[model samples]
Target: MGLKIYNTLKREKEDFIPQNPPYVGMYVCGPTVYGNSHLGHARSYTSFDVIYRYLKYCGYKVRYVQNITDVGHLVGDADEGEDKISRQAALEKQEPVEIAYKYELSYFEDMRKLNILPPDISCRATGHIIEIISHVQALIEKGYAYVTDKGNVYFEVKKFASYGKLSGRNLDDTKSGERIDIATDKKAPEDFALWKSADGGHLMKWPSPWGDGYPGWHIECSVMSRKYIGDTLDIHGGGMDNIFPHHECEIAQSEALTEKPFVRYFIHNNMLTVNGSKMGKSLGNFIVLKDLFKKMNPMVLRFYILQSHYRSVLDFSDESMTAAGVGFERLRNSIFALKDVKIAENDDLTAYPELDALKKEFLDAMNDDFNTPIAISVLYEILKHSNNELNKADRDTAKLEAVKRMIFTFTEDILGFNWNMADNTDSGEENNREDKLIEFLIEIRKQYRTEKNFAMSDKIRDTLKDIGITLKDAPQGTTYTIS
Candidate 1:
């Protein structure tokens, strides 16, 4: 079966077909670079990353574009309040540009840790002021937008009969659902800003048709997506929170200007919760990716996120993460063990129908709207069968090699797991030194146990455990697993 995508616009799974065959244009709403990346960022980006990888694996030339909101994203996420980056700048006593660049780097650093491939084009809002001004001008000329004497341009939501079509929120619904106070300059409460006049003290202002101002949060995506990837994108994705106001406004202004469909498929990933509560910095429950990486492998976090469907809410906690880590370790250990198995010079892969069936099931799950949870479950089934086959005395080396290739293809190539990092052996010389030190410590602990010094032996094991290493004592020797 061909790929099927759950289009949020249609509220159903539809066959995935790009506007142009063998070419796909995908745009995902990226983070506003005012703070460090968090669990929510990980879930959203990793979900898109898998989709990107699978598209390429299926022989599509995908041009992935992600935006960096360096300016004009208000604190209220609507037309009111200070820009998020500017607010952060004030609190930190830094320039707004400095704050945006700093956190933008931090965002990419965390993404790299998760093995998420970088987008083909990373556009910044501040860098595209020229195109934004042109877009706002077109909207005004088309009579869908109005400029205020206060130097603010707002989209006339009433002009677009299909203003809330993508979000399924009528103008009445929008007015009721709005959390932020509406700007007085807007003619209607449902109308959104296309461009905002920069205040006298605003640090990130640019010369626009109205005055010295910056583009609104919603307009940047519409302008950047159109500039980088035509007026109509094959796929547009983001977290579910963007359904209203942000994406709703984008649809209004974009279609009003282009007089054409904005996106073919609108895909949205569900939000992530922490300990059953909404994760927020204000709630004091926000989990940063860099902080979480210090506790466990980033790959483990990536693996944990993929255990749930993209359209499902992923409730995260220490317990759930620990369980995921154990499962990931099992799969990693089994796949890596095959490296030691010798491969037969000539072997037929079709000899094993069970392996072939498992592979097919894996593809089927992915084909059905990127169902990663089901796809990952199929990986476990493959692992179980491979273990059984490897246990037989007459196990076929060629079969073991096939298992290795299959696991690697799914886990690393498609799923985007970095095995070297997961195994805690990525750094060659440093890892070797660390391994030798761990062995030395294990040997010393063994001596302590041999002498019956229970206090020293237990202390050593507990110390290692505190540092995310668990010691397992087998009949032959002690082995450790790093979480």
Candidate 2:
């Protein structure tokens, strides 16, 4: 079956097809760079990273553009609030640009620690003021937006027929949900500002048609994506929380100007929750990514997210991370075990049913809209068969090599889990052997201590500790994690 995705715009699972055959353009709304990124931010980016990686794995030449909102994002997402970056700047006693730089670097560092590749181009709103003004002017010319008496610009949502199609919201009923105070300046209750006039203390003002002010948060994505990726794109993605005023306003302003479909596929990731409550900073329940890195490597956090589908809600908890740690260890350890086994080489091999079956299943799973959970399950299934084979103590070289290549290609290359324990240099082999030997020594030491042979146990641990191998015995078992 061909790949299919549940598009938020259509509200159905549609067949996947790029506007252009091999060249695909994807736009993901990036962090605002006002503060430290949290787990919800990680989920949105990592989910899109999966989509980006899998599309390239399928031989699509993809240009992924994720924008950085350095200005005009509000303190509260009510569409009428103080600029978030400016607020952060004031709190930190720094220029807005300084705050943007610090958080933007932190964001990329966290993403790298989590193995998320940076986008092909990261366009920031502050950098693209000219382009944003141009787009906003186009919207004004098209009559979809107009300049307010206070030098602010507002998009006329009622002028666009398909304003709420992406979010499936009724215009009349949107006052309570995702709505700000419909100020007297706006044409209607659903209307959102395309540009906010600069007050006297505003730090990040630009030269727009409407005097000196910053571009609206919604206009940033609309203008930057269009300038970088043309009038339309293959995919656009963000959190489900942005389905209304943010993305909806973007739609109205962009389509009104270009008269082309703004995006082919709209992808929205469900929120990451803590104890069944949304994990949002505004809600006072959020875990910063940097703090998470202090506890566990960010890759563990990424792995935890992948255990559940992107479209499904993932609850944040210690138990979930602990479980994900086990899954990651098992998955990587199995790859390591595969490399350690001895297998024969084969040239003319048309008779390996087990090996062929495993490869086919993995490819099939990954091809189906990048169903990574199923692909990971296939990894376990392959490992199960290989483990049974290993138990026989006679390695099938062809099968071993095939499975090794398959896992490395999908897990290491595509998923970015290099599984470095599967290396093949002499030093690497020696290191692996020493690791196993040290593990055996630790186990034997535990047994000796159990029998009250304290002297021998002490001697063994001392020798290992001197050689850079330390042991920690936990309630679960006596094992070693690299320092």
Candidate 3:
């Protein structure tokens, strides 16, 4: 079966076919860049990173565009609140651009640590003001938007018959769901802003036909994605929270202007929760990525996320993270164990059905909606088989080589685990031998101490202490740690 993705637009799994064969254009909504990224941001970006990697693995030339929302993301919906960057700038007593730049750099740094590939084009919202204004002008000319007396341009949601198709919300229901005051400038309660006029000397405002104003939150994505990718995107993705107003409004404005489908497939990853509660800064329950990295390896965090299906809700807890670290170490250690195997000169015509089955299972799992959890299970199965083969008294050297290549292909090449332990030529093998020898001597020392041979134990401890390794004794037991 070909790749099957669960499209939020159809609310079902659909076969993925790019608009142009072998060339896929995917746009995922990126961070607003007003503050440090949180775990939720990690989940969304890492999920798409896998998608991007797998697409290339399947021989598709994919151009992934993730926008940086440096401006135009308001505090509240319907464009009646201050921009997020503006609020952060006010509190920090700096320009909004300064805040955006600071957090944008931090975001990429965190993503790089997590092994998330940078997008092909990261278009900033503020950098595309001219394109956004032109987009709004096209909407106005098509009779789908109106300019208010205050120089605010609002998209007439009622004018677009299919405004709620992507979100599956009708106009009446959307209007009734609004519990806050509606902007008087909007033509209707469901109408959203295409542009909002600056009340005073707004720091992020730009010159548009409507006056000194800025593009609306939803308009920013529509303009940037279309300009960077195309009028029609092969895939549009983000967290599920953007389903209703943010993505819905993007579809309405873009389709109304082009009279064509804006996105072929819409992918939304589920949110991350902490202790069964949704993670958000407003909730005071979010864990910043940088702070979390202090206590955890970034790859362990990525492994924890991929343990569950992308569409499934993942909960964060100390126990879960610890278990993930252990599991990730096991996975990595299994790969490292195979690095010492020497390839036999004779090619193995030996048909290993187990190896073939493992590869098939992995491909099947990934083909079914990029089910990474199942794919990881297959990795463990392959590792288990490799361990059993390695422990045999007489091993087939050629079979071992095949297993080694298979593990490398699945884990490092396909799954994005760098696992460069084999690449460190001088230290990698030497350290392995040293670690084993140290553990052996430590075990011998333990036996001596158990029999009350204090002199031998002390001699062993002092000899090791002369080197870099240090021995620590605790309530559990005596263990050796590298200094």
Query: Highest lDDT: which candidate?
Result: 1
lDDT of 3 by residue, 166-276 (tens): 888898899895637688777788888888898755688887877899888899899988887889999999999899899999999999998889999999999889988
Q: Of the pair 1 and 3, which is ahead by TM-score?
A: 1
210-308: candidate 1 lDDT, tens digit per residue = 999988899999999999999899999999999887888888878888889999999999999999999999999999987777667788889999999
Off by over 4 Å in 3: 421-483
TM-score of each: 0.88, 0.84, 0.86
217-314 per-residue lDDT for model 2 (tens digits) = 89889898998888998899999988876888788888888899999999899888997897766787789987666556555676678777888899
Off by over 4 Å in 2: 176-180, 282-284, 340-343, 347-350, 421-483
Off by over 4 Å in 1: 177-179, 425-483
Candidate order, TM-score descending:
1, 3, 2
Q: Which candidate model has the greater lDDT, 1 or 3?
A: 1
- What's the true lDDT of residue 34 in model 1? 94
Query: Over all chains combined, what TM-score does candidate 2 have?
Result: 0.84
Error of 3 at 203 (Å): 1.2
